[model samples]
Target chain A: SQQGEEDPQALSIQEGENATMNCSYKTSINNLQWYRQNSGRGLVHLILIRSNEREKHSGRLRVTLDTSKKSSSLLITASRAADTASYFCATDETGGAQKLVFGQGTRLTINP
Target chain B: NAGVTQTPKFRVLKTGQSMTLLCAQDMNHEYMYWYRQDPGMGLRLIHYSVGEGTTAKGEVPDGYNVSRLKKQNFLLGLESAAPSQTSVYFCASRRPGTGRFYNEQFFGPGTRLTVL
Candidate 1:
């Protein structure tokens, strides 16, 4: 079963605009991670936010976590054409073997 | 160091055939995982290992088996291939964390498998 569900199954934005993707999960999580995958390639770990952390930033990426609502969001500041990719959210469920359950993902397209 | 690598980037097998996918990581990670990605399904865990000589089933373990004889290698096998098993398989490895949280996982390029 899928632990997380991403909103806006697909998003298209201009290159200079900011792109935000949201993910909501069902159960409590030890941490939440965001990954980016280019077409026909493996995923790359972008950022991770622990349950105790409300927000985190890495380069052009910012991740926010809200354990109370079981939701998280990823913000790509000043999106670039190179940033076009599929983004997925994964959750490490509490009490489990630390296995990650992923969301369906949001396909983001940055138009130049 | 090569973080993680998978063998046979692409493969095609007829129904009822068997094959094994190999995953090797040079980071000496303690945890290894296998996942399959399909359209609209994202990535689903197939099997995982905590250490050498240890293996455990994941969400979709049916028709699949795994082995971890060496700390740096994890193998996923298919006893009998089915069309439903056609998907892109990815292998990931991560070092164990000190506390409850786990470190980030490094993923391989992935293997594209097509079952007819």
Candidate 2:
């Protein structure tokens, strides 16, 4: 079974707007990571938040993790048309050579 | 520095034909993984390697076989191709670290395989 499940399988917004995506997991994970994938390309690492950390920021990207709820959310402020891609959340149950289970992903479209 | 790379950007195979997919990393990462991406299934791990000459089965490993003979290269092999195995294959590598933290993995461009 997949460890992570992302809500709002698809989303659309205008450029410069904000986009929020949620991810829920079924198990206790050591850490969770977010990735972005453009069509016909490999995934690019966005940010990673550990279970001990509540929130993290990287430029326009913000990530929040609630270990108690086994869930995480990624927020993109001032979204750009280039940000249009499929966003995925992956959770690692343990550390050191751990396997990452990814969610079905949320397809976000940023219209210019 | 060519973080991760997979050979044969695209391939088409006939049923019962066998082929091998190669993944190489230049970052000296100890953990290597192979995954297949399908529409609704996301990315499912086929096999993974913790270190050289070590391989382990993952969530969906029934039809896939993997080997990591060298420290920097991981190979995924299909003895007999099946139509069901058609999907985009991705290879990733992560450097080892301690504590309860997630390590960012570098991914290759991916290989699109079609079995007819």
Q: Write the per-residue lDDT of candidate 2 for residues A40-94, one digit (tens) a residue.
A: 9999999999888999999999999999888999999999999999999998885
Off by over 4 Å in 1: B98-100
> Model 1 - which docking category?
medium
Report the TM-score measured on chain A for model 2: 0.96
Per-residue error (Å), model 2, residue A31: 0.4
Q: Give the TM-score of candidate 1.
A: 0.98
Candidate 1 chain B worst ten-residue window by lDDT: B96-105
| Candidate 2 residue lDDT tens string, B1-116 | 99999999999999999999999999999999999999988899899998999999998998789889999999999999999999999999998853464588889999999999
Model 1, B2-111: lDDT tens per residue?
88999989999999999999999999899999999999999999999999999999999999999999999999999999999999999999999723467888999999
Model 2's alpha-carbon lDDT is 0.92
Native contacts recovered by model 1:
0.66
